[model samples]
Target chain A: MNAADLPSSCDLVVIGGGPAGLAAAALAARAGVQTVLFDENAGVGGQIYRGITATPVEDRAILGADYWAGVGLVDEARASGAVIVNGAIVWSLDPARRVGVSIAGKARLIQARQVIVATGSLERPLPIPGWTLPGVMTAGAAQTALKAQGLVPDGRTVMAGAGPLLWLLAAQLLRAGAKIEAILDTAPRMNWLRAAWHLPDFALSPYWSKGLALLREVKAKVPVIRVDRVEAHGRDRFAEVAFGSASGERRMKADLLLLHHGVVPNVNLALAAGVAHRWNGRQLCFEPVVDQDFGTSIPGIAVAGDGAGIAGGTAAAERGRIAAIAAVAALKPDAILPQVQAIRQRLAREEMGRAFLDVLYQPAPGHRRPVGDTIVCRCEEVTARQVRDAADLGCEGPNQMKAFLRCGMGPCQGRLCGLTVTELIAEQRRSNPAEVGYYRLRPPVKPISLAELASLPISDAERKAVER
Target chain B: MFKRLGSTGTEVMLKVDGKPVRARSGDTVAAALLAAGIDHCRTTPVTGAPRAPYCLMGVCFDCLVTIDGVGSRQGCLVPVREGMAVETQLGRREAGR
Candidate 1:
């Protein structure tokens, strides 16, 4: 389990099992390199493409069926000789591509010549008053529950959020026989006009049609409402959700309230490893700056997927393939760059199309600014007013806000509030949110116990080597 | 590409707490459990809210249940194995707590 105990070295070590990691491992193994794929989840595919346990009621369901197909891809990669390790929570990554992994209560070090990072992203929760209530859940979580687990959040549910995921989850809930009270789409009014440019790209596949079909089906089944704001009301658990509509503040009694603002990259590993990143103004994320080959400032290390930025599964898969090809070329110079270039070009086209769609579907500016009493950081119980107060008191950046108000210093490490805090600060400071920038993500993304780190089987020699 | 569901009639049987449950061979434990009308999987320690696989994927811990004496097994991830002893976890009693 120690570094030396590894097979001397592997050609590539992929840090996630989502589309990006799965694609990278499959391509690297196909190229005749020894590869190892590791994921914290027992199953592969990150959050967006979470595996479904049951046979989907409909074959053309966008999220469920497509996600199950990823399992087949994982099997194909394993069949191609890539070592697949599930339920392996990778804690740290050394500069030398040495990964610290905890598998089944055992800690081990995996060394590889090249590393591909595809850790993916997490849901960005808006700190509304009753957001932390028991019945309140993320839209992704709701979809995962119904699609994969075959359990409804409740018999009656209200879906609210601002992304494609919101509509997608709403449709799925309708199919599961859950009486959807209403779907509140918080996407800005301007997005549809802006997103029209990307319609041609979406027409490339029937997948987009399937998503629209789901929406239409949901519209037929339930009332779809477009609201500017939503407020969850309850003493302990969520009892009802109130939305501000043109008519007035309408309240609906519901057992389940699903919210989806958007997603932020899981940047803890990159920050822990000291990778240089810049604030992406458009996507509102801190993404590592990479070259054409996905190589970061740290050579031999590459990043892909939403962890790199907020691109979808298709982009992540392409980026993974590109990183794998680049990693192979690093070890074997004879590998031609033309092949990589062709792949990069195709990926760029797809990425541009997705980016256009994202811009078209971005959340409205008002959702970024919740009511004063709304908690911004549920982990630390910091309210939106506290973040604003901290900003007024010379706390400019999210990191400083964390220091002054402890806003982003929680278990989530600001993945939920980092962008929202930045935007709030920017609004108060009369500057761009990008100017305030992102919070630094420390290592051990998911809190690892001190004992777990100490028990890692990395030998003194390996430790010394890493230190050197 | 495989044809969409509603076309396949592939059937598989796996044990849930030593009882045979009918499921498609590739279906996850959570999927099969749902198809079989087994709702309550585990309980949250703090609130004791009955949590049935919130996120069938491993991201959400709501679906954690004991499978073959292994506590906190993700029902969505683990393929239903023959003779697998599946038990509902009462609360968060792992050592990490």
Candidate 2:
């Protein structure tokens, strides 16, 4: 859909098409309010269920049932009369709920009564040496290629890092008949002890048996090595992976090195839009400060899904529904949202073992806060040493460090390196991440073309002000 | 770096760095480059270092390429099209191109 086809105003506008956005848009539109959802991807399933409708993979079991669950979400949103616009880039959102969206390289401003920012999560930056090499990609990227294009590593593949998604991606790749060199388990041994307190809840949670089965499935096929440190080594593209295990440091020839630690909220848009955010030490990232209804400090705006906080796909959908019901209640005071209470209960159940997972898979400080020549900011190619040196020179925060070294001032707008930079600065300054803070983001959050900006429909008074 | 599992989608013909490449119908430009083993789509503007699609989910700008007459378009976000002309961005895109 183009900007020309979109409504100038809507009762509700969702900033994503993932599980949360789809659920929120569906519930809002079903309550008789006009709803519109804008997604950057070509499809509605977001990252987790990418290519749900257009996947080239024929067999459903190949990508697994959890991925296929996104189809029902897309269907529900479409059937609910919500305007789901794919390939639409939302560049700006003001506290007043005015949204600047660009579609097909054409920009338009849409007024929304209520907005749900469901922009989901992105993989955490793994700042080991040589990570910027061509063949080194996040494990989520591998999953996207597998699900969206039925693509898998055709050469020697080394999977590194710790998280449920790591094992999940490994199982998916194995299912796709891809060869694996070895799995470098980066979950620090100390994490197991720290995470043991949350083990009781994890044992009762739904992910317990599923996580075990996934680990078993992948372990049965490939060698899983518990590694304390890992580094990607290549001149241009990833060719070898060097890792330190209990046995000792080992290096092996590799064609593709898929790295993943965990995922953090993609907070660029939310932060740029002036939503209040706080550093989450447990999650090891900055997340939007939100209320029980997922409402941010900015009124009329709600953040759901992993963007609000990482709680996996099921909880994202439930949170989306709850946010949508809240939106409906706010927009149409008489709107009856009978299932919100039940949805919240389900959401609580979905988030039962999240603490366990967070503590267990929390990336080690050595990996998160790199030293020496390891690159912290891929965009500016800033080394961790440079950032630490700047911090030692009294660089207060990420924003200050950006002026000093341009670490977070790249095209990615700090999505890749924001957490790493913040943590690095904090570690150097002998301060907590909360005290050190994050990048002060502003719009246009995602880069928009000059042509697209020029194409915006100008108001008469605004045009007069600029002309004079 | 990657290969297709199922060869079922309709064939999309495009050129990468002016070389003819065949990709699936649903393939994005990044997927096509990887499927064809054409790593390092663009050299970084800062240091001219070779880079490919690191995230493939649109967060990483490493996959920025020139599609047709346009410059610095995210390869992973743009879908593959027939007769598409993809150029490997050598460095920073020239101003007023």
Best by lDDT: 2
Instruction: Tell me the whole-model lDDT of each prediction, alpha carbons only.
Output: 0.70, 0.91
How many pairs in model 2 have backbone atoms within 3 A of each other, for residues 3 or more apart or on separate chains, i.e. clashes? 0
- Candidate 2 residue A330 C-alpha distance from true site, Å: 0.9
Error of 2 at A128 (Å): 0.4
Task: Check candidate 1 and list the clashing pairs.
Answer: none
Q: Write model 1 residue lDDT over A1-468, tens digit each, in one string.
A: 232244646778899988889888888887777888888764666675564323344444434565566666666676767888776777788777777777655666667788998888877655666776656767776666444434454456788887667777776666555667778777767787877877788766444676677678778877877787788887656788988866678888887788887776777787777778887766766788888777898878899877888877777888888888889888776654337767777677666555555776677777777658786775466778888877788887888787787776754567667777888888888888657877876656554556666676666998899795
Interface RMSD of each: 7.7, 0.8
Off by over 4 Å in 2: none
* Segments in model 1 whose C-alpha atoms lie over 4 Å from true places: A1-8, A52-65, A196-208, A335-338, A458-468, B1-97
- Give the alpha carbon lDDT tens digit for every residue of A1-468 in model 2: 779888888999999988999999999998888999999988989899899888888877778888888899989999999999999999999999999999889999999999999999999999999999998999999999998999978989999999999999999889888999899999999999999999999998999999999989999999999998898887877888999966899999999999999999999999988999998889999999999999999999999999999999999999999899889999999986666778888999989999999999999889899999999899899999999999999989999998999988888989998998989888998998999888999999888989999999888999999795
Q: True interface contacts reproduced by each model, as a fraction?
A: 0.14, 0.94
* Top of the candidates by DockQ: 2
lDDT of 2 by residue, B29-57 (tens): 99899999997899988899999998999
**Predicted candidate 2, C-alpha RMSD:** 1.0
